[model samples]
Target: MQALRIGTWNLASGRDGSGRSADAATLRAAVAGVDVDVLAVQEVDVGQPRSHGADQPAEVAAGLGARDWRFAAAVAGTPDPFRSWTPIEPPVLRGPDQAPSGPHYGIALLSRLPVRRWSVLPLGAGRAKLPLQAPDPRTGRNRWWWFPDEPRLAIAAELGHCTVVATHLSFAPHTALRQLVRLRRWCARLPGPVVLAGDLNLVGPVPARVFGAARLVSAPSYPATAPRVQLDHVLGPAGLDPQRPGAHRLALGDHRLVTVTVHPR
Candidate 1:
């Protein structure tokens, strides 16, 4: 059995807790310094103003000196200032140094191991209400609120040793449950030993039951200031002993990177 370190995080387009935008160097360090063999990233940007219109996934791969990476765009424009929109297309790998043709938002996976095949499966296309704590338009007071939902996606890459899947499920509770069911079925068809990682936007226990996979990490990963829930995760097929599963706190986003060490089945 070969051991591997897998990690997941919602990058929030590389914005730190203070709302400071990350540059190429900062982004690079975020990936390289994390010390994980494979990483699943969510809420990434491509040619979007919030993220300085950068091709984030590609940059991250370059930062890690990785040749294998895949990105799936779930929407066409930035979601900041939340408004309804549609995804331009499914996520695809950007060629080295290739510029984004338009602003896009999505999820990605970066790996030091070479990927043998790739596929992307999109979930619900309809809008769903997502609760948030934001400034109310009328009084500018910070309050609990709701916003237009974004498309969800699952991108999978078959590596030489294992297949890895990454995704960001819906924030809405009911919607998230449905997505989990779909995710389980989708993963079932992929080659094993499979590792699924990402900002699931749900509690740790929920997915564990559905996937029949061991939940390797359980630390709070969201609201970086005082995280109370484990929104990020790294899961492996059942009966696999995952060692040293934990979360790595960073000043880069509203999430603590979730990680685990597992031997491919």
Candidate 2:
């Protein structure tokens, strides 16, 4: 059986100096550090003002020696408020305003394999009504909320005999559930084996149910530092078995890189 290796990470590239623009050395290390046939990335900035209008997806892809790269701009373009920190609501939340041309902060899939087919699945309509709160490590203030306008998206690509879907879901449980429903429907329509990976933003039985019945493998992936929630995941059809399952911690983003190897059953 042919083995397929995949890796995913939510590289938080934005206006904030959160190590979004990974240096060449860091990118090289990240690529060499993980073992995967393809890499799926979230929060990649494209022509974002904060990123100095750099094409981060292309930059990282080139750094990893991956010439074939696919990208979907969840947020096309918007107004930049010069200096503003207020978190806007979804749909209107205005993703990384800096990036007004393409996905304010979109997802990207980079691979050395030839892409046979591709499509994007928008997660929610208008703006997702989800809430996320994180304690400011620097300020000790809790209840910080930021809603991303670009609804989570699923990008599916056909690689030889397998199909790969990469997405980043909402933190809201209901929104995630709705996204999964759409995901399952899409997966059912694809030909050949299918594999899905992303930051689902939920934990426990919910995820298990969505991908579990589909016979996709599930492994904990989240909080790159010290994972308390299994927000990230990798799932494949029942016919495939996980050869190895694990995640990598990096200082560049809040999420870790989940890598998995699968063998046909």
For each candidate, the alpha-carbon lDDT, in order, equals 0.79, 0.65
Instruction: Give lDDT for model 1.
Output: 0.79
| Alpha-carbon shift of residue 259 in model 1 (angstroms) | 0.7
> In model 2, where is the ten-residue run with the lowest total lDDT?
88-97
Candidate 1 worst ten-residue window by lDDT: 88-97
Top lDDT model: 1
lDDT of 1 by residue, 114-233 (tens): 778888887865467667776566686778866777888988889878888998988876787788789889888998888889888778588877777888777887777778888888
Query: 1-265 in candidate 2: lDDT tens per residue?
Result: 7788887888877222243455545654555545567778888776665456667776667666664777766655532322222222332221112333453557888776777877777665324433455445457455645544445677887877788888887666777777888898888788658788887777845775776544243544556666766777777766576767777776567777788788643
TM-score of model 2 vs. true structure: 0.77
Q: Using TM-score as the measure, which candidate wins?
A: 1
Candidate 2 Cα deviation (angstroms), residue 41: 1.0
Q: Each model's TM-score?
A: 0.90, 0.77
RMSD values, in order shown: 2.7, 6.0
Model 2 vs truth, CA RMSD = 6.0
Against the true structure, candidate 1 reaches a TM-score of: 0.90
